[model samples]
Target: MIVAVASGKGGTGKTTVSANLARVFDAEVQLLDCDVEEPNAHLFLKGAGIEEEEICIPVPEVDEVLCDGCGECGAFCRFHAIVSFGAKPLVFPDMCHGCGGCAKVCPRKAIRETGHRIGVVGKIRADRVTLIQGRLDVGAPMAPPLIRAVKARMRKEVPAILDAPPGTSCPVIATIGGADFVLLVTEPTPFGLNDLGIAVDMVRDLRIPFGVAVNRVGAGDDRVHAYCRDQGIPILLEIPEDRAIAESYSRGELIVDSLPRYRPLFEELARGLFDGGSPSGNRAGYRPFKSCQGRFRRRENGCALELHGKTCCGLDNRCGKPPCEDKR
Candidate 1:
């Protein structure tokens, strides 16, 4: 089973669930920290021998001497990584998607693909589990390539848990794309509930079987529970708010290791998710939902839904609501 642990917003304990899941998982497991831009899984699973490899992407390199500043390359680039000023072309490596369209379109054949280092992938072993993570170079505008680099090494013989980045964006989708199930992690606060709704929309759209794990319970009211109940989303587990959990996290200690009492809780969560089916059998886009009493509703060829008498993205995110503050 390949499960992607994600959240619609950051600081919702995605890494907490991912790391602890690896620690307690009964079978041989691998953890792929796909949050390449800001990976922190290493902080907790430290002091392990790591095998590191560099990850690079191909970027266009222009041989200025042989080329006339033609505009074909610029026009062919949908990303506009290369711009032509009459006959002089300027390349922005950061913006390049490595499609090689510019090089292919160059009339003078002056463009060549060059290796550009974007990040590195590290494989570490701790407590018999493998921890694989990617670290994107600072200031690198791209992360998907590095995310793919980390995922390419997934151990097919064992179950894997992907620690994805926060937010409902490309990076998050890239990490969770092929996951069999996604365990959405959220807290029990107004912000948590709000983001959880957004996250639900995302997973439903992708059609992956999912359940919510309410972290930091008792930190807020029962509104989160009410929302989940109203929507018929399964509440997989609830990690009550605890000061000791925070204290242990601050010191880079695994929760299951630091608090032995919590071992069975995570173990239960692991068994419940993987027991449903194998990765190949589960697809994120096949699940059913309400509001439309079925699949996402479409009006005028665009996705839309009504919630609390308000029309918004079919995902039910209260986008117009005021931003969530750091109540914690």
Candidate 2:
């Protein structure tokens, strides 16, 4: 089971919940800090044997010798990574999404792909929890590619927890895209409630089973509770506004490690999420959608629910598994 810990905003105790949850599971869990731009889960895990590998994305490279400046590559590139009026096309490495579309559409095959280093994926065997995190290179514009690289290293045999980047943006979507369940951590303040509502809508749109974890429970009013009640979203865990917890966090300490008595809360959360049954009432084997091109298509009976792409029947697609590799 893959549980993605996400939030609508930053500094909402998302990492705090993720690290504690992994600690309680011990060696039974694999923690993936998918916030490539600002990965901090490792600070709490602090395990040894840290190894890292440089990650790169393919960017289009033009072979001027074979180039005819047909402008097809430029027209094909949606990101404007390549542009040409009549001469050899100008390639912008930073703007490229590395889809290889320009090379595929080129009439003369003048375009080739070259690696552009964007980040590094690090692995740390921290005690019981295995920490895998992606750190984006300074000034790297895109993060989804690095996030994908981090997820690609996930050990499918073990339950994984993805510490998603804050906000409901592309990076957050990339991290939580294929998660089995999503745990949204929020605070009790008005800002928390507002962003929580936005995050809730984002998760619901993805059709992923999700629950709420409210941190700093006593810091604000009951508006969060009221919102959850009205939305029928379950409040799985509540962390009290304790000063000791804050102090421990300031020192980069795990709450469960500092306060042994609080281990039960995380253990119960783990049991509720994976051991007994998911809040969605579906087991791990149930994958809601199959892949078709770059999008996900849910086939039930004869109807199809296309996600993140245009609606289409399964007829034209050789639908097999999720996260369909775009061959375009």
lDDT of 2 at 253: 98
> lDDT tens string, model 1, 242-326?
7989999999998899987666557656655554224332232224222222222221122111111222222232223221222
Clashes of 1: 6
Task: Give Cα distance to truth, residue 9, candidate 2, Å.
Answer: 1.3
Off by over 4 Å in 1: 276-328
Cα-lDDT of candidate 1? 0.76
* Model 2 poorest 10 in a row by lDDT: 299-308
Clashing pairs in 2: 47-126
Per-residue lDDT over 86-182 for candidate 2, one digit per residue giving the tens place of the 0 to 100 score: 9988988878888999989988888889999998999998776899999999998889999999999997777788999999999999999999889
Lowest-lDDT window of 10 residues in candidate 1?
299-308
lDDT of 2 at 310: 21
